[model samples]
Target: MHRAPVVLERAADREAVPDDVWVELRRAARELGFSQIGVADVDLASAEPGLLAWLQQGLHGSMLYMERHGLRRARPAELVPGTVRVITARMDYLPRATSDGWQAIAFERLHRPTEATVSLYARGRDYHKVMRARLQKLADGLAERIGPFGHRVFTDSAPVLEVELASRSGLGWRGKHTLALSREAGSMFFLGEIYVDLALPLTPASEAHCGSCRACIDVCPTQAIVSERRLDARRCISYLTIEHDGPIPEEFRAPIGNRIYGCDDCQLVCPWNKYAQRASLPDFDARDAFDAPSLLQLWAWNEDEFLRRTEGSAIRRIGFERWRRNLAVALGNAWRETGDAALSRALSEAREAASALVREHVDWALAQRDTPALEPGS
Candidate 1:
C-alpha cells in the first residue's frame, strides 16, 4: 500500500527522523545499487580490546595504519565529532559471468600448483574507488534532505571499524574467516560506512549462522585463519605478498600454492558462497592481464607494461617491484611442478630484474629449477 511521502527537507530544518524513514532510506539505497542498507548506533566499545590486542600482537602485519589509530576506531563519535549513528552499506561484487558453482572453479585453481591465481576481489577495478564514490553520493543525498549535518563517509580507510559496524548493523554476522557474512550474500561483498549526527533507526542485528562450519579455517594455505575469526597475518599469503616489504618467508613459500597477489581459498571452500551475488556495475568486470593470464605470459611484462596495464587497479599499489617479486614466486612454483623449459628460461632472465627485491625473488625461483625430476611409475 502507498503510504505518506516521507521526505527530509531544508538544512538544519530537521529534528530526529521517524523510524519509518529507514524504509525510505533503504528504498533509495536499492535504487542506487546497494545490496543492503543498515543503521547502527555508535556503541562499539566492546570491539576496542580486540582491536588493540590485534595490533599489540602485530597480527595486522605491515599495515601501520591499523596500529596508528587508537580506540577512536571503536568509538565512532570520536572519529567524527557528531557521529551519533552509522549507516553501513554492502555491495555485492562477484564478477558478472561467474558460472554456476564458481567456487569449485576457484578451489580447483588452488590445487594446480603451476597456475598463478589472484584473489577474486582484485580481478577488476579498484573497489576502494567504486565503493567510496557511491557511499559519498548516498551521504550527499541524505545531506540534501536534512541540510548541512556533520557527516563522514569511509570505505576501507583509516580509523573506521568496518567489520564491527557491519556485524552490528544487521547486515551480517562475522564469519569464522573474519569477514562479515550473510546467509543471503555470503561474504563476497564490499562494505562501506556513512557516519551521521542524526539518530536514524537501527536495523535488528543478524544472528551468527556459521554454526560448526570450519571450512575457512581448514583450507587456509598459510593457516592464516589460525582460529575462528582470528587471523594471524604474518602467515597470510595476502599480507606476505601485498603488504610485507621484506623477503617472502621460506617456511610459508611452498604452502602458498600459486596465489601471486592474494588468497581466496577460504572463501572458495565456504558452502555459503553458493548464495554469492553478481555485481551490476561494469566497473568491476575483469580486464587486461587479470583475466587468467598464464604465468609465463605475465612474467614477460616489463615495468612499463606493468604500470600501464595495472593503472587505476588495486594491483598497481604494490608497484612493479613487488609485482615481479610475486610473479617470480609463482613462476618458481610452476617450475617446481612441471620443470618446463619455458618456465626455466623465464626464471633465468628474471634473475636480473632491475630492482634488488625482484632479483632476489627471481634467484629464489631459479633455485627451484633442479627440483627432483618425477620418476617413472611402476
Candidate 2:
C-alpha cells in the first residue's frame, strides 16, 4: 500500500510549506518525544469499506460508539469541520527504564496460571494524559514553524479512526493483529492526530510487512484471532475482561486464563516485537498493583480500594463492577486449575458484594470450582 511521497518545497509560504517541511515536522515531533510523524490528506474513502465490514460483522461488540458514529469516523472532514489534512504521530511506550528481563517477568506470570495477568499497556499511568500533553507540545512547535492555523488534536479519542490515518500517512502499516506497526518499532506505541485546516504535503502510505506471518493469529489464547487480519472481538480476552460489561460468556471463561484485566498474548508473541522499542518518556512504568497479583489478592479489593488503586489508569474506566466481574472469571479459572481452599473461601467471601453484579459473578465462580470438569468446556 506504499505510495510515493508528494513533492513540495519548505519555504514557509502562506499557501503551504514544501515537502521538506515534513522533515522539519518529523524532527520537531521526535524532539517533542514522538517517534514518528506523517501527514495524510483527509480523504479516507479507502478504509470506509473495511469500517462498514467490521461493524456489519458485529466485531465491535458492545462499543456502541463505533456503530453510532457510522461513516463519520472514516471521513475526517465530516467529524471535524474544515479538516483538510491529518497530522498523524506515533510515540513508543515500552517503558524506557524497564529492566532488560521484563519480558521474561511477563511470561513467568503466565506460567503460574493462578496469578492475575494484565496487559502490559495497562500497568502504567493512563496514556491519555501523557500522549495528549506531548502531542500538544508537538502541535505548538508546528504552529511556531508555519504560523498558527485552525487545528484540533486527539489521542486515543473515540471521535477518530486513528489507525486509518496513521497507515495512510506513512507512520506505519496496519498489521495482521489490527495494530499500526512498523518493521522498526512493531506495535508498541501510541498514536495521536492533528486535524488541520491547512493542507500540508501528505506523506505516502507504508507497505504492509506482515506478509505470511500469522504470529498474532496463532498466539490468541482464546482463539479470538478468527482470521489472518480479522478479530472476533467478542472472543478476545481483552474485550471480555475490559470492554465487556455483562456476564462473561459461558464459552470464553476458561480460555480467558488468568487475564484478570486486559490481555497481551497476541502482541507478546508477535515476532515483530523482537524489534519493539522502549518509550523515551517513563509515563508507562509498571504500577506495583498489577505486577504479580493473585486471584485472592485482587478479589480482596473493596470498591474503595479498587478506586484508590486504579485512579488515573485506563483500567478505572471499566468501573469497579466490571473490574470485579472480570476478576471473578479469572478466579474461577484459577480455582478450576487448582482447587485451593483459599480461592473457595474468597469466592464465598464475595458472595455478598455491594454490587449484585460482582456477587453474581462470584457465585458463578464458586460453582465453577465445585465442578472443575464443566469449567474446561470454555
- Give each model's whole-structure lDDT: 0.79, 0.78
Error of 2 at 309 (Å): 1.6
**Among all windows of ten consecutive residues in candidate 1, which has the lowest summed lDDT?**
1-10
Off by over 4 Å in 2: 1-14, 18-21, 99-104, 370-378
lDDT tens readout by residue for model 1, 45-77: 888888888889988887787777868899887
Quote the positional error of residue 5 for candidate 2 in Å: 30
TM-score of every model versus the real structure: 0.92, 0.91
lDDT string, candidate 2, 1-378, tens digits? 111122222223348766777788888788878888888887888888988999999998998988999999988777776677888988888876666656566766776667888887888888888877777777777778777666677887756988888999998888887888888887888899877766688888999988898977876777887887688889888888888888888778777777888777777767777788888877787788986677778878888999999998889999988988888887877777788878878788767644787777777778776565432213
Question: Which candidate wins on lDDT?
Answer: 1
How much is 242 displaced in model 1, in angstroms? 1.4
- Scored against the true structure, residue 375 in model 2 reaches a CA lDDT of 29
**TM-score, cand. 1:** 0.92
